[model samples]
Target: MEEMMRSELVSMSSYCRRYGHLKLHDFSNPSFKKTKYSPTKVFVVSSSSSNSTSPPPLPQNPIFQSFFFPVTPSPIIPYLQHCSRNTKKRKFTPSSSSGSVKVISREAFNAAVKKPSVAVKKPTVAVKKPTVAVKKPIVDVNKPTVAVTHDRGVRKSSSWVKSRLLGKGGYGSVYLATSKDGRYKTERAIKTAELSRASSLMDERRILKRLKSPFVIYCYGDEIVREGTSDCYNLILEYCSGQCLADVIEDNQGGLSEFDVKLYAKDVLSGLSYIHDRNIVHCDIKPDNLLLTPVDHRFRSNGFLTKIGDFGLAMEKGSVEYGNGCGHKRGTTRYMAPELIGHGVIDFAVDIWAFGCSVLEMLTGVQVWGEHGDLVYDDWVSLIGHSDLIPNIPSWLSEEAKDFLKRCFVKEPNARWGINELLNHPFLSSNQVFSHNGFIYE
Candidate 1:
């Protein structure tokens, strides 16, 4: 019986070698009768017919062990072992059930038999962020939006909603402007002029760009905007909530108190000093151009901070032209200095002379040259230019105030005290504070 069993196993091995590609049922194991043929479960070996003693021992190769033993065996394992042991060169013909054969090269077969390499994960690298450029937006006249470049080269867009007309001048009309989007908390004054006649506004913008001082009205920036059919040049400036010194005096029903005058004079001098140091001359320095800003207790108890504004008539010190044409003066007639009227000479001293006139008006609440009366422009020119008379300094003023005005009113521009010298005067050195009686508007 044992001899018969060995013979049957030898026949089965021979049958497997002849038809390795065909599916074979395992009749010896009835339990596997219903299972389909799987390559991983079918590695079998038998003694060769020439040497029928004992079946040759399985290969000790780790590659063979990793491919076959622990899991169910595959027919490809013994086929691969045969390929590796055979000395004769033979093509590996892998067949499918459809009777088609695929010829795999020796190198491909070897590569398939070799162990697959484990994949390595690469280290992550950091990428730098890219910088973005800002593009300027197109101005929309209907929306009234403007793209403004600020101090640090940073650009931003702002929309100003125009409200009431603050005032009008020869250069342009000043309007109260508030930010439409609430980005800017404070109210602003926008001075606008038709582009064709915007020379004064342009010049003022250039001059204001160079000036920086708390006592001077600040220029935020300027933009060219379209209004209806006309392109307008707009200058954005700090808005003073109070009023001009002229209006303030009129509201008070008389000249301001000496305390108020000294307080305002100090700030004006400080602003003048800053501009004069840079060789700028404010040709117009009347009370109407000196603006009062509301302030908190930290600044002054008077509820106002005097700031110098209206730089439309200002020019660089040596570049000032005395008249436009036909012997007409550039500034208001009442504040013109003797040198400015007589010789057409203009300099920083003209500002001092006008400042003196403004102080007098603030004290008297009236024009320095009095009413026009019967005097025409030429008549007034003759009277002021040819005569040696100066504006009358009131008798009620203190000696220090009288002396300060005298220094400012000197006929010869060279002899007049400069802004620095006047700042040291006793009139401005007073430390006394006064109470404000609140503004009275007509």
Candidate 2:
């Protein structure tokens, strides 16, 4: 039995070296029949007959014991499979055997190889978590929404929404607004000032309230607005849809027409007459303060309405006592009168001086001292004396108009024409009748 075993191993080794990839199954035990494993074939090289050729000599006893006897079925089968796929043949010199070499046929080796044995484990199904339902939030429709209230303890008026800023001054800013309560047009202006500077706006509000004329800016009322953490005062006034007289003068080629000048002069004098009768003096009177109403093309010949605005510097006559000739010279430099610069007696005559300079700008397109530097009392005197030297004064201007301006430009405030007197002047009264024939009057 040992000699036969040696002969079988020698033939198997020879075949393994040639077709090294062939696998050898263990059939010595009955447990392999029921066990599970991958199926594979044990290949054998072709031999004519077992008795024809001698089997190769077996390797040394140590090499033989290490290669076959000690190896278990698990490792030897895998080694056989690995060697079966590798086609390279290994050279082996077997030891000399006593008995004749018995060659193993291909059919005999294949019939001896048994099927593989390995059991496969079945896969398991994972357990899933149970599902839970969620609840939705519910709201009541009968509940009233809370209105945002300010800290001033007064409810905000829904009448107007203040929007973009139109301008800014020493007190605060003026914003363009839209009316929500139909109290006024969507386009209106709102002036605001904090309590720190609210005194000026409050004074202007009082002055505007006392006066009501087509030649004056209209006022709505005063309201408190919450600006950040503090309260602000808002003085809502009429919005002038037209440009200022300063812009009007700039647009006209060589200044306004003589007829236009006369019409505007009449309007300004009318406003001044109304205010002067009330003992109020508009301390600041300049082209910028005179605003023209929107032009009405249907009555285009009548032109636009002119009104005196910006009463910030106005004061009632004889209200504030002027002593020591130290009154505040609060007005534009170009339109300030000689008496005003000297800190002399200030009265309605100051407005008359500014009005004269404004008229000159209308007819001549130039300020009184625009050509002269730092308008001194002497320069003013020389300016009125040489009236022809001034540019933009039409040669056709009536002598009555020149004389009217001369009275307004007088050095003595007492001798200047009163607002009422200027209304009856030939330059204004005569121009009114001539306007019927044509728009332009020489």
Model number with the top TM-score: 1
- 260-356 in candidate 1: lDDT tens per residue? 8888888898889889888777889989999988888556757788899988777674442433312435687778887777767677888999999
Candidate 1 error regions (>4 Å):
1-158, 183-185, 318-328, 371-374, 431-442
Runs in model 2 lying further than 4 Å from the true structure: 1-159, 163-165, 182-186, 295-302, 320-326, 373-397, 431-442
- What C-alpha lDDT do the candidate models reach, one value each? 0.72, 0.66
Error of 1 at 262 (Å): 0.2
Expressed as tens digits, the lDDT of each residue in 31-109 for candidate 2 is: 2222223333232323333343533433344444444534333454555666767744433332255222244455545
* TM-score of each prediction: 0.60, 0.56
Residue-pair clashes, model 1? 1
Residue pair clashes in candidate 2: 20-83, 20-84, 21-83, 21-84, 21-85, 22-84, 36-118, 37-118
Q: Please name the candidate that would achieve the greatest lDDT relative to the true structure.
A: 1
